[model samples]
Target: MTTVNRSARGRKSLAALVCGALAAGGLAAAGVTTSLAPGAANASSHREAPLISGQPQYDNTDVYAFVSPDKPDTTTIVANWLPFEEPAGGPNFYRFAKDARYDIHIDSDGDAQGDLLYRWTFKDHVRNGDTFLHNTGPVTSLDDPDLNITQTYDIELLRLRNQHVISTTKIADDVPVAPSNVGKASMPDYAKLREQAIRQLPDGSTAFAGQADDPFFLDLRVFDLLYGGDLSEVGRDTLKGYNVNTIALQVPSDHIRQSVGQPVIGIWSTTHRRNASGHWTQVSRLGMPLVNEVVVPLNAKDRFNASSPWNDADFLPFVTKPELPKLIEAIYKIDAPQEPRNDLVSVFLTGVKDLNQPPNVRPAEALRLNTAIPPASEPKRLGVLDGDNAGFPNGRRLTDDVIDISLQVVEGELLGQKNDLGDAVNANDQPFGDAFPYVALPASGSNGPLAQGQGGGNRSQLEGGSAELTASAGDNGTLVTTSLVAAGAGIVLVGLGLAWWRMRRRDGAVL
Candidate 1:
């Protein structure tokens, strides 16, 4: 009887530790997570590695999968690339790298190896390269002659066994890609262009490739010493105005599932680039948010991106003994979870038992989803933690609040801590789409924050009736004073520089 009591207490204590560790880890790491806006929550996978961070075009920022809410018989996978796109960026706006292969891999049987692969390869075209303009005029349609820069992509489905390709089938070709949301001036009806890009594939699937507002929302300020070093700067959405290039596909459930009996499937996305030697190299890999960003050590971050799920054992140590929790403990004075964090292994690697886990599941880092589980009518941001089984960690939905859910779970919600730890960023800046290709429309370049000294159209004219330049009676005097101050500062700087040079010369230092 005493042994049983002690065992129960130990479990409870361990749960508390795990909860605290998770919260601390989240607060200390990349400090970003899922969105909580109505519809689907955006999951983060942005610039998690040094090598991939340098190559935005080939970076796989986020991957989302869920049973299509409208079409319950199918599953949709949305993968985003090129993080933090400035909407105002023009002429050379973002697009998928033509030289790279963007692939979505599925482990249908839970062997930690992908049994099916959906690959997208893009090709760019410029109707008139001589023009610096992205569009000659308003792009009435995707094929508008005014649209100078355009892109098309092909989709190929490959069946794999034992990591070797067994069969390849072309499902789509020459499909028009949804161009960037250049602005209201260029794309008069951007949503119409996006819808037009949504093609009905020969394989009875739906495909779209184009720019979308970055769905992931979180307070990235946690990196500033866990939020202004005192948690004051907590609620702002750091990615509110950014954009990402998205590739979405909604396919019949039966197409990718192993069998009706094994309904659970694991999904992940990777980007491979062709080197100068023409050898393809996997540069970015994403399955779950915050894995590469915080879980893996810096030295192994690049390696993790290039690795496959089947070989995830090499990274087991990081999950078992995460460094984030320890850092959190040191700073927050919270107890870190004990080593051998099997709870995390189950959540991050293998799917949780009886929820999304496959029978005899092999531990691996892939987002697992049970297609058999119908979509939730009214989804909760907290996901399964809130008893909403259809949400993230089941397979990410654009609306599942992964950041809060993950932080709460790590804070011990699963083990019964009942904590509500989160980054306080509840929803995305924009609402997600209700139908297929459910991400929010990309933010327009013309609609972003105004530049310094720029005035809005509605700004009242100055006293001189000129909004462009505000004239003042003291303008000449002000200019003279500013110039004198500048000249005085420059003279002072020059004098300091000459004195420093003389000192250096006296010390026989190099010039």
Candidate 2:
């Protein structure tokens, strides 16, 4: 390992130590775990990396996959933009990248190479002038509602098989843009406004561009402290009152699928921007294997993002390199009880079951969904743990409780039909709309407390306006202690061994 790599690993070790201590101290007792595990090195989604926390604009907030609830033969792919945007910050609102190239790549052949790509770009209308505030100011009425600050964008459907580009018709002139939610009258009915954004494609596919609810929900304060050293708890609470900006795309499954026989597909998103030197640069990439790059290790994160499924062969060595649990083991100073657990290599890098798969195509980290298997209309939030494979790793849905799913799987739920975790995997409220713009919650008010209403059970509401970002005492602060310290210690020792092996390799010493 390079000196920089070593240093990064060392820092990760120290972080793990602090986090372990905190977890043991019960600091995360009040925290809520959403779809993603907050503190563990085994995070399953993007933006979990320490570096990207400062860059929310490029954060891969959340990934959703489900057969279109309205159209059974089509799939709705919705990728959220801008994590945790405060609804009150207005005047200058958030918008999707205008110059940046946004793409949703799909791989249906099972090889991981994208067989089809949907590309998008936008054009802003900041120059247009219509200076009359409706329901206020001098005049009571304006001649046109369309002459406001609007934007126009185009979509391109690329067929990778033939390298063909199909462009859609331009959205002509100007259209009324949605305003920030300041009051009932100021904000248009969000549902109606979103419907207006949908543009019909020549091929029968439909696309909509506008701000929607953020599907991801986590008690960030709890998780951050957990990683810093608090494990008094082992589960998560649902986020019932938050929202995010989203770009939704729906298309006929056959339009993007490479083969009718296999319905499985790989999906990913990328954001790019032109630098001062006039060169386009990648801001971030979020795909099938979600945060594989972010949580892998600092030294390996960038390399993971720069490579793709097609070129994975050239990057397999780096992809299979392990550093997480090893670093944890080193920091905790404990010897692993098992052989493969000694290093993160065997579990995180090499597949425990299907070992012959391609490098980037490793099932160890990617969200693997067999599309041929029809989705369960009313999927159990616990997913495979509940004998339902329709959620997560199988392709995540908005309501799937991924945090619990990941925790259960890591505890050996995949080993057989029997799950020992029991209620640990069964305790969560999963509710989402069954149509386009699937995330149905409204944008939370800035000063309102985090509300905890059950989708079908015990309901709690935090009313009035209070600028607190935590759940009520009744729902929060529930802690459960476990033998995580011993487990953490075991993983750290494995890291030390791996480090020693690398040192020997550099010194030309025989094992």
* True-structure RMSD, every candidate: 12.5, 17.7
Clashes of each: 8, 22
lDDT of 1 by residue, 101-200 (tens): 9999999999889999999999999999788999999999999999999999999999998888999999999999999888877888999999999989
What lDDT score is found at residue 246 in candidate 2? Answer: 64
Looking at model 2, report the run of 10 residues with the lowest lDDT sum: 1-10
**Candidate 2 CA-lDDT value:** 0.48
Q: Local distance difference test, per candidate?
A: 0.77, 0.48
Model 2 TM-score? 0.64
* C-alpha positional error of residue 129 in candidate 1 after TM-score superposition, expressed in Å: 1.5
